[model samples]
Target: MGQNSSQGARMTSSVRVIVVGAGCRGEIYSQFASIHPERVQVVGVADPRKFARTKLQQKHKILDENIFEDWHNIVEREKFADAVLICTPDRLHKEPAVAFAKKGYHILLEKPMATTAEDCTAIVEACTQSGVILSVGHVLRYDPVTHKITELIDAGVVGDVMHIQHLEPVGFYHFAHSFVRGSWRNEAESSFALLAKSCHDIDLIHHWAGPRRCVKVSSFGSVSHFGKENKPTGAGNRCLDCSIEGDCPYSASKIYLNRVKQGHTGWPVSVICPSSLPDIESVTEALRTGPYGRCVYECDNDVCSNQGELSCDGHEVHVFDFLTQRSTKHKAHNDAPRNFGMSGHGGADYHLMAAFISAVANNDPSHIRSGPEETLLSHLLVFEAERSRLESRVVYCGDAGRR
Candidate 1:
């Protein structure tokens, strides 16, 4: 579990990759192949949706024989690639991860490893036992802003990292779209709001804490705004049919259509429909019948609209706010080099993919920053924080939680 240096090793050959899920995250991670064809190539892809699979195939020039309608089809075949990117949904991570790891394919699993602690541990064990590299999707670790913050801390410019306060602004429209009426709306279907959305925040906090374990954790949050109890007096079930849609801040029409009108039809809009380029008609149709079109308060979302978690090891303290994002003016960040393209997650996506490709190509685990054990530890902390929030008590991590 060595931390990869930003200077990745030279690849002797392209690292062949099989994408297990062709959804938004899958599409984003696989774009690395298009950027660095000599270093990485997508050899296979699997998705239940034909649109997703076909979209990835067209982008990466994947063969029709290699394209699969289901991940199980990929797993059933003999191992045909050097590595696998398990970008499946939150609940669909473990099976493909274990299967690919057992097949001797190094893995790049998306964040929160799995929905539960047991499943996370199982995926880790499978990879560890198989002696294959497992890198989790903690993309923020590779972001330039994060690197600057850590560099400042290490240089003692912050003078003893005893306390850190962090805030992540899950914007109103974003929260309404992703958490209130989207795939991760229900805890049973996806995960608790914190783990589903803020695992990266917890992982960042854990990374900053450095070697100190999160021994004690207490959290507070609940479904505050986007619940049936908060529905407007005369609001319809769906935004398209609602009379108050024009006045509501979380209106689907406003959020989706406004972005289209602004010529910003990438994310949150592309996600609403199966079309590669979602237009006004497709968007309107999706709103008229799809989950994204539902009224925020009338949806079945149960995740917390706002949440906070506090972690301490009896000596140092860390605080995380999952609602507000305040700007911090820092000279170091302003002066940091911008070599990586700021496309996805401030270009951390490119760095993470580069590191993983280099790691697999050279058979060197050090090329990855978020190794399996490190990712599992951070994920455990997140689960504990969620537990504390639910039970309304501080939970002690003791020996296991420590590094």
Candidate 2:
């Protein structure tokens, strides 16, 4: 089959797409849409936050009529779109996805598909029933370097996959900015760090190791550094209000001010100052008062700063959050030397999207590598691992256990 005909129709024009959750990932997806207009067109965006939606429209030059605050509003009014990109928080993925799938729309869903296995199954069922293509966002599987590693392993370049070690050095400032003081701080609102952050790692491990039955799994994590007990004495209630804001490295004002200075704009900035707190003074004040600027130690943040060790089959995988530093490295079985490391976004998102676009254009499931079923298997493994860690017992990989 050629790269443009799932049904008998040749796709001569762009595929219409609606992007939900105009946050950080949404912006990136919008940029990709702009770059690949022939194959993808971002015709609509849905986000509840006024500032977020406005920023997405302005950044992408999308028309006001094409923007929506409520995702359901868009689904109810618009009859069709080739696909819907769900970039909402981990907890918010299900509803929009279920709705879109039922409408027979192909979906490019963000990672950690949903908080639980049931939600993930529901999404898979919805898409299956409607005959829509459902591709979960497991971007790492598509990354160039990662893909090379996988290819090498598949081709017997890597000796029989023995063990895999993956390290996600959740950077110091990044931990404070996103995981600690950011939107993902609370478990109820988001999820455990494993599910919210390292679903990619779990997915990658599953891809490399094949469906290995999880023999034993355990994890231990806690909000070690970012809890009230760790709050510094004399720490003010807010960053702007704090007397030692300049001395603190995790200061929201300092971090975002630098982000803006470097032309790094989007969800990170809008998250700190969601409204017109127009001037720098207001912005700083807003950060101090807003959720983003609160003292990491004093805030209501409940997610862990350090989670460690999940073993599947005999392959033990370890994940850590060094809140005081930033570094990332992964070692997978491959024909190559095996040691691989990278500095930035880890190329996960870039790779994942490329594969999804290619798969859609090609209209082949094999081309669409990261399907909901495979990704869900990895997600279930993580959930089981967390359970084992909490209950202090071995947990198996549900029905999707190693085939």
Candidate 3:
């Protein structure tokens, strides 16, 4: 209900930020600080990975003294920046978020606040008690396509949204690289695949489904593919040694090495190799030894490949399986109409970054579309959906008395 535009735009100043993780999300969001140097500045950074830390430092020109391997080194010390951007892995979010929030650093915490509800509550409490601005990375709200669709629904252009069908289409190689062979491969290591990957979709759908609170929820899914039973008969544990790897679509060599050949050295490549610009030799060596080298079917992964019937507030939502065939990055057509159709997912990333900065700059929590309360609602849906999936029964999603 408050002003959405930058009416109080601070044209002459910038909000200082300290990036606590130099991974993809952290690095990309921090680029906003660089892009709008007049509105934001990167004063500090903390990331454990040498390559990621160095890449961000060189990009932002952060002083050597301001960069550290651990977030505690800065959060434990004096409050150095106006904001702390926490893009650490799923399991690592709570502590840095709580630490920074308590220190009066407004936070930009990544999605799925935490794996457990308790940790999420603790973080929300910390931010509320500290009187800090806490915004979640629900980038869909900032996405133009999403906004257009939301406007259409609200304006009655598409009539009523009685039922919503949303597909995440977590592409094949991407699934194998991240869910099967990468950091989010296991539930224990990171989180349920739903919370880790598709919380944005949940929040987006909920936003579009306004006024109608989710009264009931249910879900059904499993590790439908990419397990030991699905492994090729002649395949070994690692792709480098497997004689049948050339025929395997899920081969790490086929994915990462192909990226190497195509001059793709950033994300999926950097994740496997230890360097920013990885060489063929380093990638091959990594395939021979690292987690990325493991056969998708033979790894310790347990998250579901395709989730079905993820009903939120009694509305059925479909979450698709990861593809192993063609890979598609979140891209937009150059000539596409801006407000008429969909924009690629990548565009929303920076838009969310800008929205957060503007909110901080103007001291308006209303500027960021997804605040702590809305984020926690989506997280609750994630947990309830998972519970319903495992328990084989419909679950109510009301806040308190309805439950």
Clashes of each: 0, 4, 4
Stretches off by above 4 angstroms in model 3 are 1-8, 308-344, 399-403
**In model 2, which regions exceed 4 Å deviation?**
1-11, 58-65, 261-263, 276-282, 308-348, 398-403
lDDT of 1 at 245: 86
Cα lDDT computed for each candidate against the true fold: 0.82, 0.71, 0.78
lDDT (10s digit) by residue, model 1, range 292-360: 998888788888988744332222223232345443345322221234322477667777887888888
The candidate, 1 or 2, that scores higher on lDDT is 1
Model 1 pairs whose backbones collide: none
Q: Candidate order by TM-score, highest to lowest?
A: 1, 3, 2
Ten contiguous residues minimizing lDDT sum, candidate 3: 332-341
lDDT of 2 at 293: 69
Query: All candidates' TM-scores?
Result: 0.89, 0.82, 0.87
Writing each residue's lDDT as its tens digit, candidate 2 over 1-403 gives 1221112234455667788997767766656665555667777889988987887677667788888989988778756567788999889899989999887778899888899989998998898888888888776665545665666677664457889887776667778877888878888888888898888887888888965645556677777888778777888877867888888888877777666666555445655665553345555676756777688777778877887333332122223435635443345332211111111144445445555666565564555667878877788888887787677676655454433
Q: Is candidate 2 or candidate 3 better by TM-score?
A: 3
Best by lDDT: 1
Candidate 3: tens digits of C-alpha lDDT, residues 358-393:
888878787878888878877888888888888988
TM-score attained by model 2 = 0.82
